[model samples]
Target: MENFNAQFVISFLIIALGYCLKKWNILKEKDGEAMARLIFNVTLPSLIIVTFHSITIDSSLMMLVVLGFVYGIIVAILGLFIFRKEERRNKGMLGMLIPGFNIGLFAYPLVQGIWGEVGIKYFGMFDIGNAIITFGVSYLIGSYYAKEDVVLNFKHVAGKMGRSIPLMTYVIIFIINLTGLSLPGTVIDITSVISKANMPLSLLLLGIYLNFSFQKSYWKGIGRVLGIRYGVGLFFGLLGFFLLPVDDMFRYTVLIALILPMATSVLPYSVEFKYNQRFVGTAANLSILISFVLLWVIGNMIV
Candidate 1:
């Protein structure tokens, strides 16, 4: 329990420092975007590659991944029906935000830091579920809102997936692992050096993103949006934790992930769909804030 608190404090402090840097103008908005690109394109891919390469998989784990996808899509469909009478744009944003979890970008490092390599392995298994949700269902929702066709473009999905440095890195690593190939000392050294930057850089990007000027009138809508997000997230998280027959470790991990706020990726999608970006941004920020507390509480209970 004390260890959980210590870890939370450390992680929160680092995030706070990022906020401070952005507030102080030390990390300019433009620079932050550039850094975000680097993290998204380069550093993150490297980390994924390295981590995935070292993991071994089996049929059961693959089944879990499929289960996660189906579960996520089901949740999104439910959210859509609930929010259907609302504007198409809002419905779209809800679909994108609700089904997807930030398992890869944010959850990975935090879980790895707290639970070590084994924890990360658990997270990776969860990520397969996350990937399916993000790429499969979330994309459909986003496209729906954008009024794009519902056809599944395997080529397009594959292309976008290919450009994901992290995904490709993971694949490469997984191949090497399958072939029983060890990473050369120099490559390991390089990955170690770059991978170290993933967490701080991610937090910094988040902080910079939060620096946008929020409208006073949007506060009420933002509150409602957050209310829905946290409410559903908590319900599922607690239900999964207490009711599911999963192992203790995965139960706790999924609970934490369920509460992981909104992903920044939703912003561009919202814009494209003509939804309220301010609402999405505010909701995303609030989720981050709420997640800190939620994780602390859950960690104390489960850890």
Candidate 2:
């Protein structure tokens, strides 16, 4: 419990520092696009490569990925049905927020801390499933909100999939492992160095992005978002906890993973789709804040 509290406090403090930096204009909105790119294109990919390269695959681990996908799909379908009566704007926000989890920015480190290297490796697999769903189903839903020319363009879809750094990194690492190739010491060292930057950089960017966009008026929607997020999280957490065949640790991890906030990527998608960007952005930031408290509570129970 003490360890969980300490780690939770440290993590929240780092995120708070990021918010303060952005609030003071030390980190501006203009910097966000580049920072996000760096995370998506470089740091996260490097971390994935390092993780996948280090871990061996197993059937049980693969089952976790399938389970995660099933959970995401279920939540997405539920959101679509439940939010049907909401305004188009709110519906769009719900669609994006429902299935999108910040697995990369937050979950990876938190899970790794709790369960060690094996947990982190499982997280990478979870992320792979997440990426596929996000790009395929979530993209379609978000695009519908954006009123994009919905067409079946396999080539365009392929190109988008090809550009995903984390996914590609996983594939490459998996192939390397399958071929029984070992990473050279120098390469491992380089990846390790770059991978270390991911958490701090990502949290800082999140803070900066929030500071530039946050408004007092947006706080009104926070309660509603939290209600939905935690409600769904608890439902799945408890359901998986009792019903799944997994052990306590795996069950706990899945529960906490579900409780994480919507991803930051949802903001741009909301903007592009003419959704209520203010609501979506504010909700995401607030959800992340709430997650810290929830993590501390859950960590105490499990750890």
lDDT of each: 0.70, 0.74
RMSD of each: 2.8, 2.7
Over the stretch 160-248, how does candidate 1's per-residue lDDT look in tens digits? Answer: 66665655565666678779888877876787678778777776666676645667877755665566667777787788789878777
TM-score of each: 0.86, 0.88
Clashes of 1: 5
Model 1 ranges off by over 4 Å: 148-158, 175-185, 211-228, 243-246
lDDT of 2 by residue, 85-160 (tens): 8766566667767786788887765665556556677677776677766665676667665553565565765677
